[model samples]
Target: MPAPQLVWFRNDLRVADHRALAAAAAAGPVHAVFLKAEAQWAAHGVGANRLAFLERNLRALAAALGVLGIPFTVLEAPRFRDAPGTLLPWAQAQGATALHFNDEYPLNERRRDDAVARAFAQAGVAVHRYTDSVIAAPGTLKTGQGGPYTVFTPFKRRWLATLDLSSAAPLAPPDPQGPVRPLGPALEEAMTLAGAAASAVPAKLWPGGEGEAHRRLTEFLAEAALRYDSQRDFPAVTGTSTLSPYLSLGVLSPRQVLSALLAAFPDALEGSGGPSIWLSELIWREFYRHVVAAFDHVSKGEAFRPAFADLPWRQDPEGLAAWKAGRTGLPLVDAGMRELAATGWMHNRVRMAVAMFLTKNLLIDWHLGEAHFMDQLVDGDFAANNGGWQWSAATGTDAAPYFRVFNPVTQSQRFDPEGHYLRRWVPELAGLDARSIHEPWRYAGGPKAYPKPLVDLKASRERAIAHFKAHAAG
Candidate 1:
């Protein structure tokens, strides 16, 4: 006769390491809910590809929850329209005593959860929130000064010192026998979870489910993980684990990832060199999470480093369209853009390349490119996308200095040397030799009708550096 528990699932979509699920179930019989906030999805700029991934993963999660005798309910709404208000009533009718959910760090999620917690508290219902996303919050890792560290290198160094290899192990599977209530099969009378007609996901891009995530990690740890530090630079190579989407959606927990990493390479478990490098990237993801929280101004689209606010941005529709459609006339940049369009993903090396092209070369605001990427990337994480764009534009905390401009041709030659990546994305250049493919302007009638370079590289580079210098000197 004890009150039931309600676990409102958000990004933490898996069952293996779910603290919220565990706590709630221990307290009482557990019921689960998945909200499909379509309006909020649009406002957050969640792309079609990512939404598809979420839908598939939610279904996978429902199956897992079903095995535990937990009834799964999927609610679709315009936005947060009634989430905070609706949850109290829903939990009451379900005979729930408390609401449990994993922590979500984005601006909107925090607002939603805070409001819901207050509402539930007002109704005399308890709420429990768990942190399963990052290993630790950003403020937890700090310098001797007792303040948040803005620089990544120092933060990464401190992160290593604060580590205990065994404690951060992945969550063990829980006992399924804790509490069971047979909901029986969904009756014909039960309301169906309505959604937009599901679409086919591109196979070449992301393969869904936590199972695929486990497979990817195991495969990477076996062989590809060693080369992750070296060959991750080449877009043509499958050097990097495509784990970002799962991590973003909480299909795979970061603890699970680090556990695999440490077990595979126990010698450097404290972190240094290659293991440290990858770990730093993971921390970067965490850093941006707090950056979005600490600086409400940033969530509002203000630069982390305010001096760059005066940056002169171009208002060129043709140029922006060219860049978006991969007709920027810069082969490497164009190729990177095209890859993003095709796969809803792009390699990290060239992500910086295309980002710099938009912000530095074309003088467009980095947010413009950031928004576009969010609209397309299947693994589009707000923190990573914003951090990357702002970093490349030299407008973020621990961001690169503006004077450091990336030359498209030189970067391509160094990273994608054989033009293999460029050729793969931009097929018109497929027939060309490596040298010509990178900077086609050098060859006569380049790429058989591909547009010529949009602007002179030398002039643009000079302009970018001069602009940043003038801003700094002034």
Candidate 2:
């Protein structure tokens, strides 16, 4: 019998379309391992919600791999730096000749992977890395000047032009090698530890697994996708596909998503309306990943644009507390924040509104809001969260203009005109009329339970603009 090829599972968990797993199976008999780096994840602002989701997905992954006759092991490594120590010894003990894993672009992850590669090399084990997390591998798409794309529009154009749908089809899971490998005690202990910490987040809201992910994709394409362009912005409607948690954790691969999308609408790339709009969103996600890889400063918590790095951001613990609690007294923004707190996910349009409220109106630092989201969101992905907060704060590539602060009241009126969304999330103001619901402060004898507006939107918008202008001038 040949020495087994070990597959080190990282963010990409699913069996189908898993390049590293496929490669390992093709090489020889395969075994899989996942490092439970709890401390490292916590340090990165990953909260209980995402951890719990990860645990659920890990179990599902184990089951899927078991069907393929691949023995899956869960090992403890409190931090990424401990990975080489934890994994190298295990591989050597198993007499594994080769290790395979998908690449992660973040600075810390890249460093950890490099260290593991070196350790394995010293131990006489070969390492193979695959780019499976993203649709386009980071740094692959460059500008005409041979620089990494900083802007999204041009990058999307290049991505579409270069992409060959036929060539990018998702790979099938490898044929079963032998009898299914029974799980060990480590799996149960890992689940217990993860479950104990994840009590705050309900498991029913998000059923983890590749099956659920594909089901969602199919459902969204069959029912809501046609109307996604019209209804996506409205929070009350189930117009958008709630696939972020799966996508973030690699329970679903981008290739599988694209394949399903193209199957439904062959002309999705060039078509107008919902398909194209959603495709652009997927491109935006890719663009952010590319940005994180190309610009090391972004992953290091620095602004993408240097000019906004030192923008005299205000420090108000009370204001920040209110924003986190969804008591900012701005209907739309509060609703968004409350939704995030309650469900561990917020609608995309509302994410923008709340983010702008924090960075622009409250004048709090974008990093604080970014951290809050990371700590609260089940689908919290570093690249997407960082990119979004930076974009909202006008500190990133293709960011909203400094002067363009979203008026939360106007936004509520436009997006949730019927107040269905606001009512659902902010029940205190549910009794108020649609007009007053948007601006609760304006309604006399309205809900006393609801707090007054945190800041005068007009004055604060002006203040934010003035601050940006002053910084630019100086």
Candidate 3:
């Protein structure tokens, strides 16, 4: 009997452009398994929306693997601690001689992988780990002094300089090896943990499959890439790529994205325009991953800047609840939150505005907003969510300057100037003109159904700045 190699699928769900799966398939006959870590995800605050997206992607993945003559099994472990014990028996039973998987950079994920690697080693099953998620894995680049660059600019420079597009091109899916017997019953219980299948985001908006991911990328580049830089800030324009959910769930690889970009704009790496600007966004994603891997505290729920960790956060449950429920009465903030509630996603520009209101305007804890986003966003990944919240709150590495708080009204007026986004999400204010929609309270016949501003914006902004200044002085 051939000693079949097992491809342990985690976040990297798709077979196309998959490093581990390709390598394993090239080696010999291959088997694949996805372990559902329910308790672990719950502890990590995995929300219904994200769970539903992941489940859909997994089903798509299983079907993809089935066509390639690889049996795809779904295993269950209540927690990361139970993973090795739960998975090893299955691997041994399948006549597995080796295991392959991709790396996830978070601290807990690293520890879990370490534990699993140890168990596999003791069982004489070789384990191989590939860095497939990010363009560059953490710890690969450094500053002149040999430390990780804390800022994004220098890191991006180094990233662009070091990248070799030829070598980084995406791999083709494995050749079909004829039909194989199906694995056991599909694991539905673990897939629908938060009942995320019932999400308000139109199910049609996201169709799970590698083919669908590529289709979205092609559509975005063809239609929106040229205007991405100018229109990305405006929530009303669909200028941004909605490929984040696919990227987060590993239905698409960064290499695949880069390849497509290079094909569309050959000079993109050295030129400036929509393609370059969008590429920078990808680099930012890389930067956050590097931050989490290089600085462990960010993963531990502590502020990147230690001084800000002790900064007083107001315990205003009412205000916090209002923000979460999209009743803050600030149009931009409310729209973003409502969009998040209605769909498992929000536009990036509005995400910044909403986070700033929660952390600075209301002076609520950044952790609260961070957890809420993780629980709500379909594309929520720890590095991006934590980095974004901390950046908005001015508490993380390379964060916004303490004094540069975002004004919700300004954000609304600037981004949704026509009130298109705001009106769509906050329908009660739909009657107001574009100019007045941003600040409905000031309108002659304000939306009576809408609540008043939760707190005076200017007063709250000043309070937050003063609080930070006082901490610095102390």
Q: For model 3, how does the per-residue alpha-carbon lDDT over 162-259 read when each residue is reduced to its tens digit?
A: 99777789999999877844534544443444556556676677788899999999999999998888989999889999999999889999999999
Ranking by lDDT: 2, 3, 1
Q: By TM-score, who's the top model here?
A: 2
My TM-score estimates for the predictions, one after another, are 0.93, 0.98, 0.97
Per-residue alpha-carbon lDDT of model 2 for 1-474, expressed as tens digits?
899999999899899999999999999999899998888987998887888888888889988888888888888999999999999999999999999999998899999999999999998899999988887888889898999998889999999999977657899999998888666776666654452375476788988899999999999999988888898998989989999998999999989999888888887899887977888888998999999888888889999899988888898999999999999889898899989988899999999999999999999999999999998898999999999999999999899988999898998899999899999999998788777899887869468899998999999999999999999778
TM-score between candidate 2 and the true structure:
0.98
User: What lDDT, from 0 to 1, does candidate 1 have?
Assistant: 0.79
Q: Each candidate: RMSD to true structure?
A: 2.6, 1.2, 1.5
- In model 1, the runs with Cα more than 4 Å from the true position are 177-204, 271-273
**Per-residue lDDT tens digits of candidate 1, residues 443-474?**
88786669998988889988888888888777
